[model samples]
Target: MKGVAESRDRSRSVLRIGGVSGGVFDRFRSIQDLAKDPSIHAVLFGDWISEISMTFRGNERASRTPDAEQVAFEMSFISALKPAIQDIAKNKQRVAVNAGSCDPEAMAKVVQQLVKDHGTDLKVSWVTGDDVTTQFKEMLKSGEKFPSLPSDTPIDQWGVEPVCAQAYLGGVGIAEALRHGADIVICGRVADAAPVVGAAMWFHNWGREDFTELAHALMAGHLLECSSYVTGGYYTGFKKELLQSRNCTNLGFPIGEIESNGEFVITKEKTAGGIVNVSTVTAQLLYEIQGPLYYNSDVTARLDGIHVADEGPDRVRVTGVVGLPPPPTTKIGITARGGWQAEVHFFLTGLDIAEKVELVKRQTLESMGEYQKEFTTLTFNVTGSVAENPKNQASATVDLRIFAQSKNPDIMSAGSHKGVAPDTPSFAKWVIENCLQGYPGGTPAMDLRQSTGKPFFEYWVALFPQNKINHEMHTFNGMTIPVPAPTVTAMYPRQQVSYDTSSPLPLDSWGPTVRAPLGHIVHGRSGDKSSDCNLGLFVRHADEWDWLRSLLSVGKLRELLEEEDTGKKIDRFEIPSLNAVHFLLRDHLDRGANSSSSYDILGKNVCEYIRYKKVDIPKVFYDRGTI
Candidate 1:
């Protein structure tokens, strides 16, 4: 129950903070529920803005008049905090969040108004300068290049021009805002863990060079950043029994109790639903991270040495987190209008599913004729399959999707079919005309609106010099504080760290093996970072770790996920403490979520698909039971 009041004395050991929101649509009740807890010193909100969101906000901003009211920030946070303002004030709790997204000034104003209307004296502050669009454009004009993260292709060669760009800020600005007596701090596009790191920094009065303490706080932020993610939301071990035994319906958000010695315990409310154990913590630790060294704007965290252990029923203690100076540059995401994209689906039922798909593809292309050449990208994918001796019609049906994108909107629009004949050059006309000519049991989906093109965006992520950003913090009392980039930074090369686990003993040493899905003995979590996907696979038992490390390599991963393998480079790393091996599949998500036609655009299900792939599992491991 150690709170902010005790932490201010500088002798107190722990600072407790609750994670209220993970993304744009997370539950609003989290804030209200957590703010009422006396043990909770502060509530952190991580409103993650993906590439598509940035593009959508940019388009929205462009469409507005000069004098029009701007509400570009994530308004859901305000709605969530409105009802909790009184409780938060009464408890004297602090608040930090990156929900400001594209507009922190406006978001801060709204929060200030809400606090005033609620008759509370909670001071609100905002951090800005993450928006580097103008500066980025100027740098581009000056012949400076910003290369793409995966391909290393310069901006000049990208073909598309960025409409909006935002640099990822660190926690320094947030800490500065807190130092100026601000109870609430709003920020635009700060790192997801910045709010938590800032809160810890302010509570413990940690200096900039407190790398060890900062790194611990950074990892704590990461664990709590995704809210229920560390509390079994996306757990791979969600079986029927587990779901029934635990209250999966109302999963609780996580809270971090960080000690002064750079160790912390992750737990949730005792009365709330969901389980918080080592497995959940390990799964989250391995989620969305690239390699052994997890880089943030403030500190480069060495996660390879970290250990997670179950302390109690709903508590997992994390320790041994090493810290290094951050890199000189921070990541910046640039969003550009790519073009128009459209898709049409045809249902394939019963036998000859493959033949039906081919027939539909041939007919649709032939019907489009020369118009097919106009499309920038066109794909024909047959998704799912019928079960042998299926009992139901739904189980016998699959989908044939024809996805197309073009720089020319007419090429993908339904209006192009207006003046054309049934066999003429129109995307919609082509699919509809194939009705009778297609294979047996083939029928076009009733929803033809997809045939009409809609604008899509291309997202580019790369590193930008942190010193170039106009990082500043504006306090509630009109005091503006300049937050400088780190003076000391290590230039770590962008390469996978070498580990002993990479060269494991031969497969025969593990004993006789049985052909089974990897998920039978292994648990995994997958997530997207721009176009690249990071898949972290782990085992519960120490004996199984060797088998997992040896069996799941870059080659093995490619073999398992052959359909997704784009011949792109894949990097591998290991975390021995967690008995995990992680893979970075470069350019795997097909230009990422914004423009990807992939069903699993975010790459969240990549691990599940890989787990479904049959692999050789040691008999002993298989006997232990499925994860």
Candidate 2:
């Protein structure tokens, strides 16, 4: 608690945001420990419903009546952090969050009740107007089309009903609310970095044109937006080394000490677990980024020129952030009712793993009979490996997974049509019917219920003009403010940059080499943007920069990907400052997290998967089995 107060300098401000929702807090320590510092100006929360959450909700078609259960689920942090709410009042610090997914007004009321229950009078406000389902529906009626950014596929081709849609709002509304004396601000779907941008602008009284400062604040927010991401939470690449430095079980969340000029040093609370350095900061900076140009509602932040340098123990100074005017349009997340999907996993152990998988697939289809035609899409994949002289049965086993989806619920629910078939229709039953008769050594990992068909949603992301949104800020007392439009207008391009085919190098120049995993010579991160996935690979040694740059070009990547490369567009960029190569795989994950059938919809494992790809590493970079 004492360290929290001293954690921030008076000139700058911000704390690691807990997460996208209060639900994330449940998995961590008590909220009181998070807000124990009095000197911290404000605590921000990003609770805006994510695209994945909306797909899971599936109740968008229901009446607009406020579902108490849903509200509690979204804003559960209010009750979860009741003590912290009291602490914010005691410290007279401000708090801003987009905890209200679709209903900011109701969320604001909940905050009011919580403040009253805590016996502390605090001013609160809510920002709204992100919802545009009505506007979208009207546009659709008038023949306006919304296309998926990754594939350019029109919404009509998705073959799903649009349920609910929300536009990504900016930090302007949050900043205006603070200017009107609101102690706590609640919002719907602002950008993930909006809270930090708003707080920094409020503290410095910065105008919209303060692009440079705003961009710096944007980076700070992006770094802390995922809470513990910058604090070794996702730094599991070198588990033994990272785990030794910090007990990741209770890893301290990141905190940004933004100086007056917008440059900030990312660090953790005193005596807290987790390490903060150039690598950790770099990992978070590259997380989920599309490219050098990062677009936000507030400003167009450029990241290609950014710099990260170690400054003392567990501290990294991040500077050189440049910004442009805000984009002319804001991105909108649209969710539609997709078909039903069902999947089952079978464990094939030891000998004849490949033969056993083929037998299982054959029997499964035979059992389905005519019912197999009901599915629109069906796929089978084998995971894990059977190695020579394996250590244990678990390691020797391979998991064969089957997935299927269909627009007709009945078709997906249909069971075995085989002789003396079970009474009701079910895909789970069909898969289980083969369990006893096929694949001599095949066994399902668990119960069949998990593989039952369930409804899924199609996610479509597009850009809509900012002027179209009817945004507003509701004050604590009884006033409303219309958010001003962006001073500088711009539009987001389809792609940030073209593929880098300029750098081509002979494959054999580096001398005696060993075929090994790329991870030993390079460390990097990967994440998803809609259906596209980006992998940013970097080498720590300066000497390896040229080799890495020349070696990881788009052509080299295609060679590495082998048959997995579907001939889709792959763009690569060079980040010389970090000696990193960034790649964006277009339309790689089906239709993104909501509808993608891949296990790794977010592409978090792309880097690890790529790292393990067979590569001829120069002998000099591969010393004693590691770089």
Candidate 3:
């Protein structure tokens, strides 16, 4: 193996790394494609686990013995890496992944076996200390309070015990493994961007104090972390014309070329489909982020000053990211069994749709009588609206969904009622019995399986002291190294940075206004982090930046999203570099994806919903063109 200095001098100043997987089930073939590319130095995979996945894996871990061959890690990663191992070894490239959910040692052992099976000499390593479920429980018993991110409610007051907890490890351990000559490093629940940051750290020989470079690398990793997200997938500008012009059938995964100076260019394979431009990159930058300050386990990145530009076709350059000291603590996710929940849907067609829904809701509640009080949450939601003057039966139909949850499984159980009266039926049965006594044109959905209750998990995100984590890296050569937490750190109080977009004239001063969808001149992307939702909206021209920043205030957003707004706090910020206005809606998704009964469980539809809303827009801006 060549030394760091020798390798740097021998190659270009840029380190090219490919991102193959965005989630656990992402395309497996991309791994082989990137591994065969000699220009790529390494491959990084992100999004292996969430709170719900952790809960499922925690149960699996609890049920399994220590000597179990098939432990609780992402098994799909093995299939993805099997065909790519020989290519990776032949090309002399490295690989890093967080597919080691709850168990990195087992994942590493599996990879080592694959390497041996393929007759490859590539070394394997694994990072530990991320699964701190036992330690977390011990701390809780010792009066350590882990406050929930959505509501700041302490664990004790949560009314449930956590089954598992995982700390977000940084890139230092990964870099240590790479430095010790490990060609592959498997990790458990590290920060999503840790692999990219660690690979860059090893390539550049950067220390923990190299804040600026680390920050830039952090943003680079963020862009590549979601794979096709930075390369036209889920892009707001994905229109029919763009689709017709470009082949998006098999979208390519992204590649980040990080320079020694910290600036990086994002691009994809030449033979692959999908487009990479400023808009795609900017859309991804705003995805799942709360504010201008992007907190990573390694560094706190200030994104307000970031600059993105189109360098060439299928390439975009990102720079000007400011870095602050690492936070003293990192986010830890704790998972607990929430309860049982179930729902039944009824279809209402044609005119008098609202009346039909009301009739059914009244009947269902009346039948439940005092039994309704036993349910923790019971909601009757009417989704969609009938079309005016009916074009077809399908278009004129709407769904009235009845969702219920309870701590007592019997309350939501699929079996006949046990406690309340033997004559009393299940929740689904109560609703279905009303079918004969229902309103005009009322029919229950065919899917009766969903009427049965299913268990769900609640996720609590809180900060844990980094020093408490037993961060370590174990190599194939039997070397174990301890990775230390950053000594230099800063505490940033939770405060929103408001941008002054005051205009000398009023909003209507531009010209005559027309009531149209906000998407006519705006593009947006929204995503959920726990229960909070971040909606990022941007415009095409620089001239419209001030108008956008001024128009989409907290009050305006609440007004636009009035139905979804539950009187929760909303944080607003501006990214002037991208001509974007971002808003964070706190406590928006009913306890997040796992326990959420909302139609938009992941909150990905919030942007489209807001964009579809009709709002008064400057006709001049619309004249330019719709996004």
Error of 2 at 592 (Å): 1.4
Q: Which lDDT values do the candidates have, in the order given?
A: 0.84, 0.76, 0.85
TM-score on alpha carbons, each prediction: 0.95, 0.91, 0.95
Higher-ranked by TM-score: 1 or 2? 1
How do the residues 225-301 of candidate 1 rate in per-residue lDDT, one tens digit apiece?
99999988889887842576758888888999999877999999766888898888999999899888889889989
State, as a TM-score between 0 and 1, how close model 1 is to the true structure. Answer: 0.95
Pick by TM-score: 2 or 3, better one: 3
lDDT accuracy of residue 201 in candidate 1: 79
lDDT of 3 at 59: 62
Model 3: per-residue Cα lDDT over 113-148, one tens digit each? 999999999999999998788789889999998887
Off by over 4 Å in 2: 1-30, 61-73, 414-422, 501-511, 624-627
Give the better candidate number (1 or 2) by lDDT: 1
